[model samples]
Target: MDEVSKNNVIDFDKEINLLRSRECFNETGFLLLRGIITQEKIKKLRSRLEIIFDGSSRLSASIFDFVAEDNFLSLVSNEKINRVLKQLLGKSLRIYPNLTARKATFSPWHVDDAFSGNKVVNNESNSQFIQVSMFLQDNHYKYGGGIDVIPKSHLEETWQIQEQSLSESLEIFRRVRNKSVNIDSVAGDVVIWDGRLLHRSSPKLTEGGVDKYSLMWTVSSIQSNHKEFLTHLENRGKLKESIENRLYDARYQELTHIKRSDFSNFFLEKIKKLDINLTLKDSS
Candidate 1:
C-alpha cells in the first residue's frame, strides 16, 4: 500500500459531503479514510491497550465495555472524527462512555446493528447509524486476515440467512465468503461503514501472524426512528472508579475544559446491559 504523504492534508468539509452522498454508499457499504490517526498516536494507543490486555482473558469476549484508556479515548473523540460525524449525524449527537473497548478476533459473517435484534435499511435514504473503526496495524488481502464486506449488502431489506437454522446459515456463509472483498488498510486509517452492511473478519492464513487491533465508535443519526436501538446505544456506566476517572479526564480534554462531574453525570445512565464480563481489575 502507498503511504499517505505527510503534506497531503484533507479538506474535511469536502470529504464530509462526499461521504454523505447517496452514490458513495450505494456502490460500497463502507468508506475508508486514510491518515486519520498518526503513527505516533497508534504507537501510544497500542502501548496503553497492551497494558490493559496484559494477562487478561477479556479478549475472548466479543465486546469489552468501558475501556477508559486515555490514548484510545483521545482517538475516539478526535476533532476530525467529530466533524465528519456531525455532518452524518445531527449536532444533537450524544457520545457514549469514552472507554467502551471492543476487541474481536476471527469474526464470522454478521451485521453490527443486527446483533441488537434490529434490521436497518436506508428506506428513507437517511443515515440511520454508522460505525467507525480505527485500525492500529497494517492489514492486507494477499496476506489474509482483514475486514471483508459484500458490497451494497446494506441496501437489502432483510437478510435471508438470518432466519435460517445455524446449519443452514453456515452453509450460506461458506458460499458467500469468496464473494466478499478484504478491506485492506494501513495503521491509523479509520473505516466508517453503515451498520446494516453484511461484513466479517477474514481468517489469518499465516501461521503466528499478529492479531488485528482496532478501536470502534458507533453513532446514530438523531432523526432515526429506532427508539429501542438508540436507547441501547445510550446505555452505559459499569466502569470502575479508576477507569471512569480516566474517561472523564480524556473527555474533558477532548471537549476542552468540560466539567468532569458534569461529563461523568452525562454518561452515567442506567445500565441497560453489560456486553462483556467485567472481571478485570483496574490497572491504573
Candidate 2:
C-alpha cells in the first residue's frame, strides 16, 4: 500500500485489542476512530460527492446508491478496513448498498438489525455484519447532530431489560435514558458499531443549523446468508427509484441511470447551480 493508504488505515490488531481490553468498544458497542482520512482526501471526496449529489438531484433517495463509483468503492476496498472485517467477521465481507452521503440528522432510537437479523454477532462460525460511519465534519454541542447509543444495548440481556415504548417523544426517551452516550465526532472520524446496538441521532437541540456531512457503509460476512440482506437493500434502492419518479422530473433520472439517456445538459445545469451556491456562501 502507498504511504497515504498506510497512514489512513489504523493498525487493526493494536486498536482492536486496546478497544476490547478497555471495554471502550465492547461496553459502548461503538468505536470512534479519529483521522481515518487526511484533510486532502476529505476535501477531494467531498468535492466528488457534491457532484454526485447535485447532478443526481439530492432529493432522489437513490442519489446515495452509487456503490459502483470509484470514490465509494475506494472506501470499501480500503486495505485496513478489509483486514479489520476479515478479523471480526470472516474472510469474505460483502458491502451492502445505499451507502449514505448526506447531512446527518436526528432519528428515532432503534437497532439496524431489528429489521434484518444480525448475522455477524449471533453466528458462531461465520462472518458478521458491522457498520462504519465516516463523519466528514465536526458534530458537537450546539450543532445538534451526532449519535446517541445505549451502552451494551447490543446484548440480548439488555434487550430483555427494556419494555420502553419506541414511540415516546424524544424528550421522554432522553430523560429516561440510561448510560447512553452522545457520540460527538470530528471530520474524518470513523465510527464502527455493531448492527444490533440501539442508537439514535442526537436531537437537534438548537435553531442554528449546521451541516453534518457523513458517509456510511454496511458490510457483512459473505457466509452470513448475505444474499437475503442484499435483496432487502436492492428492494430499498428500487423504492428510491419509485419515489424519485413520483416527485421529480423524468429528465433527472438520466443523470444517475446514465444508460437510460443522455443527461449531460441537466447534470451540467444542476452542478453549475451548486457551484454558484457554494461560491456565494464562501464569499459571504
Question: What TM-score does prediction 2 earn?
Answer: 0.65
Query: Taking the tens digit of each residue's C-alpha lDDT, what string does model 2 give over 1-284?
Result: 00111222343334544324224444445666654567888887767666656645443224324434556545655555555555555565555433556554455676664232443246222225677877776666676445666656666332321223555535545644766667766666676777767777766677776455667767765555555555544444455467734334222233223321222344324323322111110121
- What alpha-carbon RMSD in Å does predicted model 2 have with respect to the real structure? 11.8
What's model 1's overall lDDT?
0.51
Per-residue CA lDDT of model 1 for 143-234, tens digit only, reads 44346677666675445443245576577577666567666667777767777777766556665555567776666554554444433333
Give the distance in Å from residue 204's predicted Cα in candidate 1 to where it truly belongs. Answer: 1.4
Best by TM-score: 1
lDDT of 1 at 131: 74
Q: Note the residue pairs that clash in candidate 1.
A: 66-99, 67-99
lDDT scores of the candidates, listed in order:
0.51, 0.52
In model 1, what lDDT does residue 64 have? 31
TM-score of every prediction relative to native? 0.66, 0.65
Instruction: Name the runs in model 1 displaced over 4 angstroms.
Output: 1-22, 60-67, 97-99, 113-124, 142-145, 160-169, 230-284
Clashing residue pairs for model 2: 120-128
Candidate 1 RMSD to the real structure: 10.2
**Candidate 1 TM-score to native:** 0.66
